[model samples]
Target: MALEWVVLSYAAGAEAVMLLLLTLPGLDGLRKGLVAVTKNTLKPLLSVVPFCLFLLMDIYWKYENRPSCGDEHACTPSEYIRHQKSVMKSQRNALLIAATLLLYWLLFSVTHLVIRQQQLSQRLEKLRNED
Candidate 1:
Protein backbone atom coordinates (compact mmCIF):
# COMPACT_ATOMS: atom_id res chain seq x y z
CA MET A 1 0.00 0.00 0.00
CA ALA A 2 2.66 2.44 1.05
CA LEU A 3 4.87 1.39 -1.82
CA GLU A 4 2.13 2.21 -4.34
CA TRP A 5 1.71 5.75 -3.08
CA VAL A 6 5.50 6.16 -2.94
CA VAL A 7 5.77 5.25 -6.60
CA LEU A 8 2.92 7.55 -7.54
CA SER A 9 4.50 10.37 -5.56
CA TYR A 10 7.77 9.93 -7.40
CA ALA A 11 6.01 9.93 -10.76
CA ALA A 12 4.07 13.05 -9.81
CA GLY A 13 7.23 14.75 -8.62
CA ALA A 14 9.04 14.01 -11.87
CA GLU A 15 6.17 15.37 -13.91
CA ALA A 16 6.16 18.53 -11.80
CA VAL A 17 9.89 19.09 -12.28
CA MET A 18 9.60 18.56 -16.03
CA LEU A 19 6.67 20.93 -16.18
CA LEU A 20 8.57 23.60 -14.30
CA LEU A 21 11.51 23.23 -16.67
CA LEU A 22 9.26 23.58 -19.70
CA THR A 23 7.59 26.78 -18.48
CA LEU A 24 10.75 28.53 -17.40
CA PRO A 25 11.61 31.76 -19.30
CA GLY A 26 14.73 32.49 -21.41
CA LEU A 27 15.26 28.92 -22.48
CA ASP A 28 14.77 29.22 -26.22
CA GLY A 29 17.89 27.10 -26.82
CA LEU A 30 16.98 24.57 -24.18
CA ARG A 31 13.33 24.59 -25.21
CA LYS A 32 13.87 22.38 -28.23
CA GLY A 33 15.53 19.64 -26.22
CA LEU A 34 13.05 19.98 -23.40
CA VAL A 35 10.16 19.75 -25.85
CA ALA A 36 11.60 16.58 -27.32
CA VAL A 37 11.94 15.01 -23.92
CA THR A 38 8.47 16.10 -22.95
CA LYS A 39 7.03 14.60 -26.15
CA ASN A 40 8.67 11.26 -25.33
CA THR A 41 7.53 11.42 -21.74
CA LEU A 42 3.96 12.20 -22.75
CA LYS A 43 3.36 8.63 -23.89
CA PRO A 44 4.46 7.13 -20.59
CA LEU A 45 2.63 9.75 -18.60
CA LEU A 46 -0.59 8.74 -20.34
CA SER A 47 -0.49 5.68 -18.11
CA VAL A 48 -0.85 7.93 -15.08
CA VAL A 49 -4.34 8.92 -16.09
CA PRO A 50 -5.69 5.40 -15.93
CA PHE A 51 -3.65 4.63 -12.85
CA CYS A 52 -5.19 7.56 -11.05
CA LEU A 53 -8.68 6.47 -12.00
CA PHE A 54 -7.98 2.99 -10.67
CA LEU A 55 -6.65 4.34 -7.42
CA LEU A 56 -9.62 6.63 -7.10
CA MET A 57 -12.01 3.73 -7.52
CA ASP A 58 -10.05 1.76 -4.95
CA ILE A 59 -10.40 4.63 -2.52
CA TYR A 60 -14.10 4.83 -3.17
CA TRP A 61 -14.55 1.11 -2.71
CA LYS A 62 -12.62 1.17 0.54
CA TYR A 63 -14.66 4.06 1.75
CA GLU A 64 -17.91 2.28 0.99
CA ASN A 65 -16.81 -0.96 2.65
CA ARG A 66 -15.04 0.62 5.60
CA PRO A 67 -16.22 -0.28 9.03
CA SER A 68 -17.81 2.52 10.95
CA CYS A 69 -16.42 3.43 14.33
CA GLY A 70 -20.06 3.92 15.29
CA ASP A 71 -21.41 7.16 16.78
CA GLU A 72 -18.85 9.41 18.50
CA HIS A 73 -20.04 8.59 21.99
CA ALA A 74 -20.13 4.85 21.33
CA CYS A 75 -16.75 4.55 19.68
CA THR A 76 -13.73 3.29 21.56
CA PRO A 77 -10.51 5.32 21.50
CA SER A 78 -8.72 2.80 19.28
CA GLU A 79 -11.59 2.63 16.81
CA TYR A 80 -11.81 6.41 16.67
CA ILE A 81 -8.12 6.70 15.98
CA ARG A 82 -8.31 4.09 13.29
CA HIS A 83 -11.24 5.83 11.63
CA GLN A 84 -9.50 9.18 11.67
CA LYS A 85 -6.34 7.70 10.20
CA SER A 86 -8.29 6.01 7.43
CA VAL A 87 -10.05 9.25 6.51
CA MET A 88 -6.81 11.17 6.50
CA LYS A 89 -5.10 8.62 4.30
CA SER A 90 -8.01 8.64 1.88
CA GLN A 91 -7.93 12.42 1.58
CA ARG A 92 -4.17 12.45 1.01
CA ASN A 93 -4.37 9.77 -1.65
CA ALA A 94 -7.23 11.54 -3.40
CA LEU A 95 -5.24 14.77 -3.55
CA LEU A 96 -2.23 12.95 -4.93
CA ILE A 97 -4.38 11.32 -7.57
CA ALA A 98 -5.74 14.69 -8.67
CA ALA A 99 -2.30 16.25 -8.79
CA THR A 100 -0.86 13.48 -10.94
CA LEU A 101 -3.68 13.80 -13.47
CA LEU A 102 -3.47 17.58 -13.58
CA LEU A 103 0.28 17.55 -14.17
CA TYR A 104 -0.09 15.08 -17.02
CA TRP A 105 -2.73 17.26 -18.68
CA LEU A 106 -0.67 20.40 -18.32
CA LEU A 107 2.41 18.65 -19.63
CA PHE A 108 0.58 17.47 -22.72
CA SER A 109 -0.96 20.85 -23.41
CA VAL A 110 2.24 22.82 -22.98
CA THR A 111 4.30 20.41 -25.05
CA HIS A 112 1.82 20.53 -27.91
CA LEU A 113 1.73 24.30 -27.86
CA VAL A 114 5.50 24.50 -27.93
CA ILE A 115 5.70 22.16 -30.89
CA ARG A 116 3.06 24.12 -32.76
CA GLN A 117 4.75 27.42 -32.01
CA GLN A 118 8.06 26.08 -33.34
CA GLN A 119 6.38 24.92 -36.54
CA LEU A 120 4.69 28.27 -37.11
CA SER A 121 7.88 30.15 -36.43
CA GLN A 122 9.76 28.02 -38.90
CA ARG A 123 7.10 28.61 -41.53
CA LEU A 124 7.19 32.36 -40.95
CA GLU A 125 11.00 32.42 -41.20
CA LYS A 126 10.87 30.46 -44.47
CA LEU A 127 8.40 32.95 -45.92
CA ARG A 128 10.65 35.85 -44.90
CA ASN A 129 13.68 34.20 -46.51
CA GLU A 130 11.75 33.55 -49.75
CA ASP A 131 10.70 37.22 -49.93
Candidate 2:
Protein backbone atom coordinates (compact mmCIF):
# COMPACT_ATOMS: atom_id res chain seq x y z
CA MET A 1 0.00 0.00 0.00
CA ALA A 2 2.75 2.43 0.90
CA LEU A 3 4.75 1.48 -2.13
CA GLU A 4 1.81 2.51 -4.29
CA TRP A 5 2.09 6.09 -3.08
CA VAL A 6 5.81 6.09 -3.80
CA VAL A 7 5.21 5.02 -7.38
CA LEU A 8 2.44 7.56 -7.83
CA SER A 9 4.63 10.35 -6.56
CA TYR A 10 7.36 9.40 -9.01
CA ALA A 11 4.82 9.37 -11.80
CA ALA A 12 3.55 12.81 -10.85
CA GLY A 13 7.08 14.20 -10.89
CA ALA A 14 7.69 12.70 -14.29
CA GLU A 15 4.47 14.18 -15.63
CA ALA A 16 5.43 17.60 -14.35
CA VAL A 17 8.73 17.37 -16.16
CA MET A 18 6.94 16.33 -19.33
CA LEU A 19 4.65 19.34 -19.06
CA LEU A 20 7.61 21.64 -18.64
CA LEU A 21 9.39 20.19 -21.65
CA LEU A 22 6.30 20.58 -23.77
CA THR A 23 5.84 24.24 -22.85
CA LEU A 24 9.40 25.57 -22.73
CA PRO A 25 10.41 28.03 -25.47
CA GLY A 26 12.82 25.78 -27.34
CA LEU A 27 10.39 22.90 -27.43
CA ASP A 28 7.44 25.16 -28.07
CA GLY A 29 9.13 26.57 -31.17
CA LEU A 30 9.52 23.13 -32.64
CA ARG A 31 5.97 22.27 -31.74
CA LYS A 32 4.72 25.38 -33.46
CA GLY A 33 6.56 24.53 -36.65
CA LEU A 34 5.05 21.09 -36.61
CA VAL A 35 1.60 22.50 -35.98
CA ALA A 36 1.82 24.52 -39.14
CA VAL A 37 1.67 21.32 -41.10
CA THR A 38 -1.64 19.95 -42.36
CA LYS A 39 -4.40 19.11 -39.92
CA ASN A 40 -4.14 15.44 -40.80
CA THR A 41 -0.55 15.36 -39.61
CA LEU A 42 -1.43 17.46 -36.57
CA LYS A 43 -3.98 14.87 -35.53
CA PRO A 44 -1.23 12.44 -34.65
CA LEU A 45 0.61 15.04 -32.61
CA LEU A 46 -2.55 15.98 -30.72
CA SER A 47 -2.87 12.38 -29.56
CA VAL A 48 -0.38 13.12 -26.81
CA VAL A 49 -3.02 15.15 -24.99
CA PRO A 50 -5.32 12.18 -24.42
CA PHE A 51 -2.41 9.98 -23.47
CA CYS A 52 -1.23 12.46 -20.84
CA LEU A 53 -4.72 12.80 -19.47
CA PHE A 54 -4.96 9.06 -19.05
CA LEU A 55 -1.65 8.98 -17.22
CA LEU A 56 -2.84 11.71 -14.83
CA MET A 57 -6.00 9.76 -14.07
CA ASP A 58 -4.02 6.64 -13.25
CA ILE A 59 -1.68 8.56 -10.95
CA TYR A 60 -4.55 10.20 -9.09
CA TRP A 61 -6.31 6.85 -8.65
CA LYS A 62 -3.22 5.25 -7.18
CA TYR A 63 -2.59 8.17 -4.83
CA GLU A 64 -6.17 8.16 -3.57
CA ASN A 65 -6.08 4.41 -2.90
CA ARG A 66 -3.24 4.59 -0.36
CA PRO A 67 -4.20 3.98 3.25
CA SER A 68 -4.15 6.92 5.66
CA CYS A 69 -1.57 6.86 8.50
CA GLY A 70 -4.27 6.23 11.11
CA ASP A 71 -5.74 9.20 13.06
CA GLU A 72 -3.52 12.06 14.26
CA HIS A 73 -4.32 11.07 17.88
CA ALA A 74 -3.38 7.35 17.76
CA CYS A 75 -0.81 5.85 15.37
CA THR A 76 0.84 2.45 15.69
CA PRO A 77 4.60 1.91 15.60
CA SER A 78 4.32 -0.23 12.48
CA GLU A 79 2.19 2.38 10.75
CA TYR A 80 4.75 5.04 11.53
CA ILE A 81 7.58 2.99 10.09
CA ARG A 82 5.63 2.18 6.98
CA HIS A 83 4.65 5.79 6.45
CA GLN A 84 8.23 7.02 6.86
CA LYS A 85 9.56 4.41 4.48
CA SER A 86 6.92 5.26 1.93
CA VAL A 87 7.70 8.98 2.05
CA MET A 88 11.41 8.36 1.72
CA LYS A 89 11.04 5.97 -1.15
CA SER A 90 8.64 8.31 -2.92
CA GLN A 91 11.06 11.21 -2.64
CA ARG A 92 13.98 9.13 -3.90
CA ASN A 93 12.10 7.87 -6.93
CA ALA A 94 10.70 11.31 -7.74
CA LEU A 95 14.13 12.89 -7.68
CA LEU A 96 15.60 10.20 -9.88
CA ILE A 97 12.85 10.58 -12.46
CA ALA A 98 13.09 14.35 -12.42
CA ALA A 99 16.85 14.20 -13.02
CA THR A 100 16.47 11.79 -15.90
CA LEU A 101 13.77 13.87 -17.52
CA LEU A 102 15.82 17.02 -17.14
CA LEU A 103 18.76 15.44 -18.89
CA TYR A 104 16.68 14.16 -21.77
CA TRP A 105 14.81 17.42 -22.14
CA LEU A 106 18.07 19.38 -22.20
CA LEU A 107 19.47 17.26 -24.97
CA PHE A 108 16.26 17.34 -26.98
CA SER A 109 15.81 21.08 -26.61
CA VAL A 110 19.41 21.85 -27.53
CA THR A 111 19.27 19.76 -30.66
CA HIS A 112 16.03 21.30 -31.84
CA LEU A 113 17.18 24.79 -31.01
CA VAL A 114 20.38 24.33 -32.96
CA ILE A 115 18.51 23.10 -35.98
CA ARG A 116 16.06 25.97 -35.84
CA GLN A 117 18.87 28.49 -35.42
CA GLN A 118 20.67 27.14 -38.47
CA GLN A 119 17.52 27.41 -40.51
CA LEU A 120 16.97 30.99 -39.41
CA SER A 121 20.57 31.94 -40.21
CA GLN A 122 20.24 30.55 -43.69
CA ARG A 123 17.02 32.47 -44.27
CA LEU A 124 18.60 35.69 -43.07
CA GLU A 125 21.57 35.21 -45.31
CA LYS A 126 19.31 34.60 -48.28
CA LEU A 127 17.38 37.81 -47.59
CA ARG A 128 20.59 39.84 -47.30
CA ASN A 129 21.89 38.43 -50.58
CA GLU A 130 18.60 39.29 -52.29
CA ASP A 131 18.87 42.93 -51.19
lDDT of 2 by residue, 44-119 (tens): 4344345444544554565677567766556688977886786665556445444544544554454456457667
lDDT of 1 by residue, 2-112 (tens): 888998999999899999999999998899999999999889878888888889999999999988766644777898899899999999999999999898889889889
Give residue 85's lDDT in candidate 2 (0 to 100): 81
Residue runs of model 2 more than 4 Å from their true location after superposition: 1-59, 117-131
Q: Candidate 2: worst 10 consecutive residues by lDDT?
A: 34-43
lDDT of 2: 0.53
Provide the lDDT at 54 for model 1. Answer: 86
Clashes of 2: 0
Best by TM-score: 1
Give the candidate number with the greatest lDDT: 1
Error of 1 at 4 (Å): 1.1
